[model samples]
Target chain A: MTELLKVTGLSRRFAGGGLFRKRKVFHAVSDVSFTLKRGQILGIVGESGCGKSTLARLVLRLIDASEGQVTFDGVDMASLPRRELRRLRQRMQLVFQDPYSAIDPRYSVRDALLEPFKVQGVKLGSPDEKVASLLDMVGLNTSLARSYPHQLSGGQKQRVGIARALALNPSLVVLDEPTASLDVSVQAQIVSLLERLRHELGLTYLFISHDLGLVRYFCDQVLVMYLGRVVEVMPSDAEPAHPYTRALLDSSFEPDPRQRRTITRLSGEVPSGYDLPAGCAFANRCPRVSDLCRGVLAPLSTLPNGQQVACHNPLIDAALPAACR
Target chain B: MLLTVDMLRIRFGAFSPVDQVTLGVDRGEILGVVGESGSGKSLTATAIMGLLPRIGGQVAGGSIRFDGTDLVDLPESQMRRLRGGRIALITQNPMTSLDPMMRIGPQIDQAARLHLGLGRSAARARSLDLMADLRIPDPASVYDLFPHQLSGGMKQRIVIAMALAGDPELLIADEPTTALDVTVQAQIVQILVDLVRQRGLGLILITHDMGVVAQACDRVAVMYCGRVVELARVDALFEHPRHPYTQALIRCIPRNGMARGTMTAIPGMVPTGMTQPPGCRFNPRCARVESRCRVDIPELLVGPSGNGVACHLAEAA
Candidate 1:
């Protein structure tokens, strides 16, 4: 597989406190590195404050990275000039988490979809024809083009968002919890739509969601994050390689009532970003933490199947042979 | 049974939010109410606890009997004493439920002192003991910290601790784990289950997730359009759902081993509050709808093995 997007040593920090006092720095994204292959979906799973959104914004250059490099299709995104960056926006797009807030209430669906083309100053033969095609592709009727955001349901509004993202035919789309706000039944519809669109258009995706079940069903590779750090990176075909990943998988309750298993609950709470601990960020809550794990930070180590994990222990038995342990 | 709701109807202005809903919780049973938003699950729980807002709602008809006493007819002063003493509610969003300016220890202690008649010192000591039982790290330190200082999971635990302060016979938890992560959700469910078992208390768990309902509930009640559409043993309901809405809901969830892009979704959105259809509210979305469903409402028909269903097909069968 050829790499479509490569990010190395990406970091973002913010300074706090008034100017009179020494400012305290908060590291939102800490030395994160990952690669997205062509036509592959990478799911970033984490809690609310784990900085997954910050990483997505950095990739889209909606916000700048404090340190590290981002290369997309042999071009350095961080080094691009304003004119070049604006041109690159046509090839990469973002779908926000909340469909209600992402779409403008004042604009009709047709105007929302045509804004991308209008911003690029592209004079197509007929904008209405393109808008109609986009709506049909996203499973919405062309007649809905004149409807306002409030006139559509949550699922319909999300479909409009997807249509707008594909208006410029972007190769890479970053989706942030596209189905979190809808009903379970409506969520199923949107997931199916997204899967079909990915295959039909040959689009790559960076899917960010906290729902583990949806992630397991949607992405080809999964990255588990905690406290602004990647804890595990596992291929979707294999079992997870870290204890935190296993805990997340085990915590998912089956819909059938007959199945029962003892759950190993992680103790304590996630530490605040303002006062992070020195060693492993998960040490306070990890059940398998050892003395070494508490005193030293773990680097990403590649496994047999080219999966990377960043834990001192790594739940090695679950990932590799005994000889490796 | 500790609590029984018989044909309870709650109305907001001219709209009937809860229409002839009937259910009950035994002394030591956890009855899970599963439904989507606008299904009136929360409103039903609030009505039973006498905590409904006075803006536009009233208990239009029927009765909520607790320990053979009707709660709907009780005075405000008398209902206030029974609320925290016999029935307690644990809301989903704990951050908003807790006061940010107050310390955890005093907030929990206050509940005990007010309802259980424990002295200030005794309540404070008991608060520490309850925190320890919940496996809160450094309970002594956490007791002095304010609400903003605690994490999401810790704040939830504090809410649960406060609910347990009065030693109530019934615990009404409304979407208690919806806002937490899956790992934290499992931990909280285990804690609630263990607490209920240890105290032999009745629990009413209201949530939208069918997975949580299957694992945590003994008996499951499927609510739709403000009515209990189906009520059965958890095993029975999962194996064979009688109502069309229940079947569609179960089929909609993506299971663990299922292939991607193969999930089946029920078409059409839920109807709004003001424009519910006359006969059967779910008729527009029901796949098995017939002409009879559009003109007449169905009563809860007792089916095999003590199951209750409110569908025309189930009633005929």
Candidate 2:
């Protein structure tokens, strides 16, 4: 498999609250690892505060990982020299969640597209020509070059964000809930645009979203996370093996009353991220939790169908622990 | 019908974003008003609540009737009495709905005391019962707790409890679960549905989620720009959506095991107030648009069964 990005045991810890020596480390992302194939969309699905966004930043090396490493194109990004890292950032771009705030209101569409080149200090043949092509690439009207962010719609602003990300022709683009704030119809338009861009550019995506339906529809493979831990990794078509994954899938209301799920919902608040359980982080709310599950960290076992699940009582017979230490 | 908003037109200064909105709500059922942003779904709810004046909006034309009473020009005093007593509103954000400093029970107690004229002890008794009915754990203890001490889901339950405290006959919840997580959203929706059935209250559930409409609503009104384009029974609406906007929206829902590229996006944006389309508001983005669609406004024709469609093509069909 041509893996564009391979993350191994990535962890990000935050010193929560209180200044000075009263240190309480919250593991924002712990023991998370996944592979994004070249030209493939690997979706990371979770609820709010599940570290999906934090993991995205960690993958792009926007923030340092407290533990483990991210190897991009078979190169350790952490070990790369500062100068090399800056050059490498061109190959790895990020699209923010809110299209409204992602772009500067001060910058016109033309200026926004050209800012990437200016930041990289790359001299183009014609900056205006480059702007036109980038806008055209994103299917925006060339005349919108003069319009500011306020003048553009939410979908248009998002198109500009995507165009900006593609300006440098990045191989890996980490989209962080890019359509969460958008209306449903506009979200569909953005998804279609992203898909087209991926096909045309042969780009790989690390799409982080809270919407399970959208992820299953758009992604090639799914990585379900609960409180900063990767609980399940399966192909989009596979039935989710993890209970947490199933809960997420059950969360979104299906558009048919006849198919409405009978009322067994995952109750209880998500445990504090810092004060996670001793054994499985999911044991508190896990429907299939047992004494063994509560007392021990679940091994991420791979099934025959290549679905990886980290649970003592996985819905599907899962994989052996891949190397937690 | 507990509530009927017929040919409702709302204006914000010179610009009217919502025009010709017509829908009905009966006791013991949920009537979902589903639409995107600027679709005037919320405006209709606000008009029903008689809070349009507070939001710089006015009922430009048409009428809102509740229990055979004309509510359009009802005096403020009567509207106030009707608001919390019979027409309670549950807004999207529960965090802001409750007073942070006040105890949860007292906040709920205020509704019962003001509307039902219950004494202090009686209001407290009623609040606890409402909280218990909402399935909140240890309602007795939770009644004494502050809003900040509660989780998002719990806080929303408290909001629902307060709405019920007033003993409302028609509950209008405008995107009540939009601020919450999907898991929490489902729970909240279930609570609302139960409230409708058990309490036998007419519910106007305003949301942008078609999925929620399918799951929670008995009947649904599909709005575009400022008008209800389609209104039908939940089963019939899902079985065969008539309006082009409604069809496009249904197609966009990512169904289970749905193949890639099957979700078709409606091209172009929903025209805002300033840029309202001349003919059918949806004609610009509609694939089946013809000369007739671009020249005249289609009237929302409700059939004998109360199913309605506002498209010229649907009329032709």
**C-alpha lDDT of all candidate models, in order:** 0.86, 0.89
In angstroms, the error of model 1 at A315 is 2.0
lDDT of 1 by residue, A96-180 (tens): 7676586668999988999888899888899899999999999998999999997888889999999999999999999998888
Docking class of 2: medium
lDDT of 2 by residue, A1-325 (tens): 5988999999999988687657688989999888888999999999888999999999989999999989999899999999999999999999987654766789888888988888898999998899999999988999999998878888999999999999998999999999988899999999999999899999999999999999999999999998899999998877888998888887787877678775566756788887988888878787898998878898778876678989878776323233421
DockQ of each: 0.71, 0.79
- What is the lDDT for B108 in model 2? 95
TM-score of each: 0.95, 0.97
* Clashes within 3 Å, all models in order: 0, 4
lDDT against true structure, model 2: 0.89
**How far out, in Å, is residue B166 in model 2?**
0.7
Q: Which ten residues in a row have the lowest lDDT in candidate 1 chain B?
A: B298-307
Error of 1 at A1 (Å): 4.1
